[model samples]
Target: MTDQTPRLEAYQSKRSRTAVWLALGVAVITAGLVGGLLLIPRADRAEPIAVPTAFASPSAAETPAARATEAATRKVTLPAKLLSQPRLTDATLQKLADSMTLQFKDTAPETEDAVSGFYGNLAKQKLTMVIAIDAPVGNPASWASGMTHGLKTSLNAGPFHDVNPGPLGGSAKCADAKASGITIAVCLWADQETYGVLGFYYRTSASVTSDFVKARAAVELPTP
Candidate 1:
């Protein structure tokens, strides 16, 4: 019989060629996958980013309410009571009123309009001067606070404590006035401004006009 080694060698060569072709196919597939990844669109491949815009600036002094409040606050005058005896003249009282930082009532009688209170002049240990306030049945604290600020400008506070909020008003009486040492209290009826002097004043006890002096009475207050 023949050795047959030559036939076996030819068969092994064919098998080696087949294995090389398979290896080449795998290499081609890997290369294609890498090329596809590189060719992908930037929009689809990249992370997203946000852009910012420029804003317009606001105008200066654009607040109207703050301006109105600033304008609304102004200088106001308050009235004071004068002595009945020893006859304090209009000129004398006017000078004192001017010096004491007082403003009289607009519709007050001519007698009261001119006569302001004296600081410390007394004949019989009784009060000779007092600041009159027109506090109605409502509150007069805002008015009082305003008055206190005004008074502090000229006079100084003393003893003889009064209610923090001069007084409360709920009556029908048209007008009421009170005067103590220097501060006066009053209360009247409500006409217009249902909550008249409501927002303006804080509740306070003041020594208002003591008309029926024999008694430390709770006098009726008038409306604004």
Candidate 2:
């Protein structure tokens, strides 16, 4: 009778141990799920990442397959319209170019008065452009379309949008060389590798936009 009693007690103890193990497993799985939820990306924002200088050069750090996949995730990086650089006068523009380490990459195509252009770095995989136009653009909307086309042709992402003129205000109105007017666009894009390019509207024709893009595509920029 005593031996039978001992065996019955042992069986109950083993069953309790099994229940404890099952509870522990459930807790671990629950913790893992909670961690996964925290790591998930937000819906509204793409992660801003470092992009390679593909638009400026022929090389990249990512694998070819990775580069191709990343290119698909890209979005518009620049504003559809120009941003007012309040003090973007000839003097101010000079300082801005100096700030970006301007180096003449090509001569402005639409000008004959020793028209030169510059290219420099604004941020990682992003570039700033400077083209000496013959005169400032009077009709921004018309010029913007040309710029959008130029960027689409130059960048891997072909589609672009321009911001409405009413919202940006009149001081931000179409370029006027005589009024010390200067129009600038800071374009950016999304993807695994982020990239940005800048376009400046001077007294030059819309054709200069494509020329500047092509020149900057092969030029070097300042280091951040």
Best by TM-score: 1
Per-residue lDDT of model 1, residues 1-224, tens digit only: 35787777776575455334323422332232223323333332212222233332343332322332333222112223222323233344435444322333442111112222333222232323323322121122232233233222322223222222223332111111121222222222221111111100111223332332311122222323
lDDT, residue 147, candidate 2? 37
Ten-residue region with minimum lDDT total, candidate 1: 192-201
lDDT of 2 at 69: 45
Task: Report lDDT (CA) for all predictions.
Answer: 0.27, 0.30
Per-prediction TM-score to the true structure, in the order listed: 0.25, 0.23
Model 2 C-alpha lDDT per residue in residues 7-78, reported as the tens digit of each score: 888875754553343234323322332232223333321322445675434443443334334344322222
Candidate 2: 10-residue stretch with minimal lDDT = 170-179
